[model samples]
Target: MSEDPASSRQSSRNQDKTWINRLMSGFSSEPKSREDLINIIKEAAANQLLDDEAVSMIEGAIDVHERQVREVMVPRSQMVVIGIEETPEQLLPTVIESAHSRFPVIGESADDIKGILLAKDLLPLILNGTEDFTLEKVIRPASIIPESKRLNVLLREFRENRYHMALVIDEYGAIAGLVTIEDVLEKIVGDIEDETDEEDEDGFIRKVSDNEYVIKALLPIDQFNDEFGAKFDDNEFDTIAGILIRAFGHLPSRNEHVEIDGFEFRVLYADSRQIHLIRLTIPES
Candidate 1:
């Protein structure tokens, strides 16, 4: 009338294989669920965590997921391209001030993107006595992408294809803008400091008043620290736009507003699906 003690004992003895089950589960051999695999890998990675790499990788992934090429593309209105018949002397200033390493060489309109020209090419040509240089001779092949393509994909393509510049195309197959590898990388990392940057303790841009505000998403963390007179680590994000996106869980649209660390973010305007223009209002530092 009692349970089988010997059978139960043998079953318990066989239970010695539980660790094997767990080991196989780690490799997901038993048709396990999603969390099992995720948990196993996550735990393993956590156990062998590398701080700097993990931080960079995490931020990189977050940055990659949140960005679209359209957000960072140079709108057609601002594009600087060379006409097939244009002289170099007239184009040098435009190219120099823009600080772009390369630009698309096109006809009168963006639709005619012929190729890309390196800004540095002008220096060598000028030094080499080819002052009448036409971009048609020096232009390199250009890569094109859809405006809807995610920034991550664009970055990957740029690397794999070994192209530095891209022409952003809209759904109608018209050039909407341009994007460079630098622009795409800066979206994930912070701005690459150049000699042109002016470091200020009050931040690069600030609010003059409540209704009118200034913002420099490139404002350094030290400047932000001084301006706000607070200590906050910018580990997860670098730009104000990144912070806003994280807070909103989506792009901030026209007139949308959110407050963070005593600063107010008002979406002035953005391109169709991304945050292009934002006004951050903060007290004078």
Candidate 2:
């Protein structure tokens, strides 16, 4: 018997709707577990009802609620800072080198953080000449936050206050690190690279095809996970190079390859000191 094509297509769509309804039934009745919701989101993503980025964001939004400030802050040691004694000549060069909008002004030491410095504030020093450089005149009060603060709460404060950056403090009130609004939002929406961010000199992750990417070995592991929807353990390693070193038990030479979980990582450029570039492959299901 010949089936009517339009009727058969409509029937298939109806069956799909029924399946989706069954999956969502628990959400309205007894309530679905976290795993159930995650599975449902994944199923929706696979069915093209939601995009991959949207799925990543949904998962991120859930995961971020459980995280605290310490999880995503840039360590104090890595923060770009300006010394209180820095001259206008020195300050301008330092700001230009860092390419950051704000810098923590330090007093005698890193522990003695004075206030926040806006790079644009230095414009007056340049425009009027470097005769007088009073950092106090240009300083904005720093926002101090405890390292234990929940990300969701921090996000609300950021939105309400219009503050872009904050200094993270320990229980003893010593600077632990720093967190920016962008960092918190990145937890929910993924890496939000600005136009001013310099492109990776070695070539950052480039999509060559649907399931393959040519990446710089120095690319941060967290950034990679956000882009690819993969969960690689990032507790001990920061970069793809770090992962390769752990996998090989030594620095990997060019063309060396390793497969962890389901993704394949192949070295594209390297030296004895570091891995430079890599090719990543993920087989489509």
RMSD of each: 9.8, 11.6
**lDDT of model 2 at residue 70?**
76
lDDT of 1 by residue, 169-254 (tens): 99999999888888777655545677755665544563455555556544565566676564656787765667778877787665
- Give the residue spans of candidate 1 off by over 4 A: 1-53, 62-66, 195-285
Quote each prediction's TM-score. Answer: 0.56, 0.68
The alpha-carbon deviation from the true structure for residue 145 of candidate 2, after best TM-score superposition, in angstroms, is 0.8
**Residue 236 in candidate 1 has what lDDT?**
79
Alpha carbon lDDT of residue 102, candidate 2? 95
State the lDDT of candidate 2 residue by residue for 65-86, as single tens digits. Answer: 7778876787675689998888
lDDT of 1 at 25: 65
Colliding residue pairs in candidate 2: none
What C-alpha lDDT do the candidate models reach, one value each?
0.69, 0.82
